[model samples]
Target: MQKIDYREWGVDTLFYWKLLIGLGIIVALGGLSALYMEHEGHWVTGMTNLVVWGTPHMFAVFLVVAASGALNIASIGSVFGKKEYKPLARLSGLLAITLLVGGLLVLVLDLGRPDRLLVALFNNNFKSIFAWNIYLYSGFMVIVAAYLFTMMERKANFISRPVGILAFTWRLILTTGTGSIFGFMVSRQAFDSAILAPMFIVMSFAYGLAIYLLVLMFTFAQDNRVIGDNLIKRLKNLLGLFILGMLFFTAVYHLTKLYGTKYHGVEYFFLVDGGIYTLTFWLGHILVGMLLPLALMFCPRFSPSRMALAIACGLVVIGGLATMYTIIIGGQVYQLEMFPGMTVINEGYGTEVAKYAKYCPTVPEFLLGIGGMGVALLATTIGIRVLKFLPETLADESVS
Candidate 1:
């Protein structure tokens, strides 16, 4: 095995400081937004009885799931013995930690009762997926942290493969738990399904890899580090494969629903009549997120272009958000059927059960969601600067 040298990000101090300051401002604003919502209550935000989980949940879920996905690079290198992937493992581990932290921050802050966080943390209710996630999320961080230790410390190098395998299994479980949070809701028309667990796992793969690619490119470019074409090709191809898997699971989910008479109404709402939700489903999730990215990755003309791959990754991210919004918010917007045949009318507002629920996210809500990204990037920036998380170079000779 050829010795590979690792180094701290070599960007100038001024650029690093500027980036830190910018990220700090975003994180500070997100904190303030959370505080504002906490003080004013859920009334200040867009959440209601119908749509309880709004934009923050979407962002939080994306981050949490993506966090698991981010570790795939390290897993591929250490567990699967892909030498080409070994050079990027450190950044993968760091990103996995930071992304989860940023996600958990948003989740905790948005909990309406932030003061009761300790109670939720300590009180283990085995029945709830939400409760299970407390353990999953914390355990994932600790395990990945240990995994990173084995990779970084020369004395601990012998245990890296075992630790990598452990981390890989744990992340799959974590993503499953995250997805089951939605999948277990049998009462909700939109969430009632068994496919969501695997669907979420596939989603984590696509979203996480997309984020890893963008971050890898940005950091490598900033420091003038080389990322060889072979590595880029592998990553882009992997991303496309994940996207196809996501689409496959999605098709099965909707097709299964469509086959059942009980789910016909909800399927109709998503595929046909549901206004913004339908648009988001087709344009945002299907076209931009899935199809466009696949085109960029597999198409001969665009596949060779780094800029094109970047755009595809960006589209995946955007489409991921759209998918989350349609799933989280749009799911809630469609009213649930409490009675199989009877229509319940709201006497006060003269609204029928068939009427869709209304929710519009406020500015503070957007700020809070955006802030989570800021937190993740901020930590990533500082982590690479303060430690040897990034490799000095990834030229073909070094990687292959």
Candidate 2:
């Protein structure tokens, strides 16, 4: 067996420092946005009583879900014993931790009362999916941290397999819990489906892998490291498979809902009459996010090009945000069927629930979301720089 080599990123300090400064600016803007929302209240943004989740939730959920998926690379190496994937394991673990942290930061800050996080920590409501996630999120951080330790520390190398297995199992449960957050909401027409749980698991796989690919490629390129075509091909193919799986679940979800007369109205809203939401689903989520990327990846002409593969991964990331936006915002905007078979009439003074709730995210909300990405990238870059997370070379010969 060829020995593997791992090393910290020892790239140009000028570029490294510039990257950190740019990310710091983003983080700072995100903090300012949070402060603005906290002081002025959610009213300053697009959120109303009808649409509570808003753009921040969209970004937060995407980051959180993607975080679980990012760990898939490491899981493939350590748990599944895929030797080709082993060299990437350390960076994978780091991305998982940083992504989750970035996500949770947005989630907590968007609460409007960030201090109440302390209350959530002390309070236990096992019945609530939200509460269950508290433990899942915290435990995920701890477990992945240990998993990284096992891989990085020579003394703990013997137990890497057991810890890797544990981390893998925990992430699955964590994602299941995340999906359940929406699925368990029986009152919401858009969310009340068992398919969402597994669908989300698949989404994490796709989104996480896409982000991982982009990061891997970009970092490798930045350092002039030899990331050969073979490794890129393997990762891209995996990404394509995951995207296909997610699409399948998506079809089943909507099809199952369409099968029932009870859900027909909501289905129409999402698929047709919801205007922007429908367009977002078709254009942003399906066509751009899934189809175009799929073509770039699977087509004989495009698939072989390194630039094409990178573009596919980038498109997947964009499509993921669009998917979340449609799910989080579009789901909330649709009027709920609180009283079936009865029409609701407006009596003025906020008494009547409009047919569709309105939401237009403010600048601050966008900044906050962008900030989360900034945090994730910043942390990831720092991790690679300070520690031996990246393999020295991912050339065909070395990785094989």
Candidate 1 yields a Cα-based lDDT of: 0.92
Give the winner by lDDT: 1
Model 2 — which ten-residue stretch has the worst lDDT? 346-355
Clashing pairs in 1: none
- The estimated TM-scores of all candidates read 0.97, 0.98
Over 254-354, each residue of candidate 2 has an lDDT whose tens digit, in order, gives 99999999998889999999989998899888998899999999999998888998899999899999999998899998878888897768625367556
**Clashes by residue pair, model 2:** none
Reference-based lDDT, each prediction: 0.92, 0.91
Error of 2 at 199 (Å): 0.5
Tell me each candidate's RMSD, in Å, in order.
Answer: 1.4, 1.3
Stretches of candidate 2 off by over 4 Å are: 347-353
Model 1 lDDT-worst window of ten? 346-355
Report the CA-based lDDT of candidate 2 relative to the real structure. Answer: 0.91
